[model samples]
Target: MDDSTIRLALERHWAASDAGDFTAEHDIYAEGAVLDYPQSGERIRGRANIRQSRLVQPNTKRFKVRRIIGTGDLWVTEYVLTYDGAPSYTVSIMEFRDGLVVYETQYFADPFVPAPSRADLVERPGTEAP
Candidate 1:
């Protein structure tokens, strides 16, 4: 698939996720897809299993996409995933084959305050720094 096509698919997937539509959310994955969560040391193989893993989660989730960038077979998305109203900054890397995701790995990090020493050098999200 071309970059634009893959980008559209990703947009649809994220939209479905925010809407809690499990079937649509997993549609971008191949039948033998694999999903990895390195922090939790877990790997979910197969589209059904991946969909099932998220299906059981109880938290109300919302996805705010920051950006999606890549070409050909590797794509990366940076987004903020809110669970029960708390935001977790997340990065998802997807490897595709034949226009379907064959492997994906997600990394999540909870928000933290910036160090006091570097306050002058840092700029918060969604703001311009001079």
Candidate 2:
């Protein structure tokens, strides 16, 4: 796929996720695609399984994409994922083949306070985590 096409697919995927449209959200993945959560040491294989994992999650969810940058068949997305009103900074790395995602790994982390030693050299632009 062309850069524009891939980007559009990614945009659509995230949009579907934000809208809670599960079918649309998983449409970009190949049937055998795999998703990994390294922090939790979990790997979910297959598109149907991937979708099922999400479907079973009980939290009220929201996604706010900050940026997407990549080329060719590799892409990375950085975003804030909020569950039940708590935000977790998240990064998703995706690998594509035949214009569909074949493998993806996502990492999530809660925000942390800036170290006091760096206060003089850093500026804060976002609010503290709740």
RMSD of each: 1.3, 3.5
Model 2 per-residue lDDT tens digits across residues 1-130: 9878999999999999999999999999999999999999999999999999999999999999999999999999999999999999999999999999999999999989889998988766685565
TM-score of 1: 0.96
Q: What TM-score do all the candidates reach, one by one? A: 0.96, 0.95
**Candidate number achieving the greatest TM-score relative to the actual structure:** 1
lDDT of each: 0.96, 0.96
Worst 10 residues of 2 by lDDT: 121-130
Q: Which residue pairs collide in model 2, if any?
A: none
Q: How far is candidate 2 from the true structure (C-alpha RMSD, Å)?
A: 3.5
* Candidate 1 lDDT by residue in tens digits, 13-100: 9999999999999999999999999999999999999999999998999999999999999999999999999999999999999999
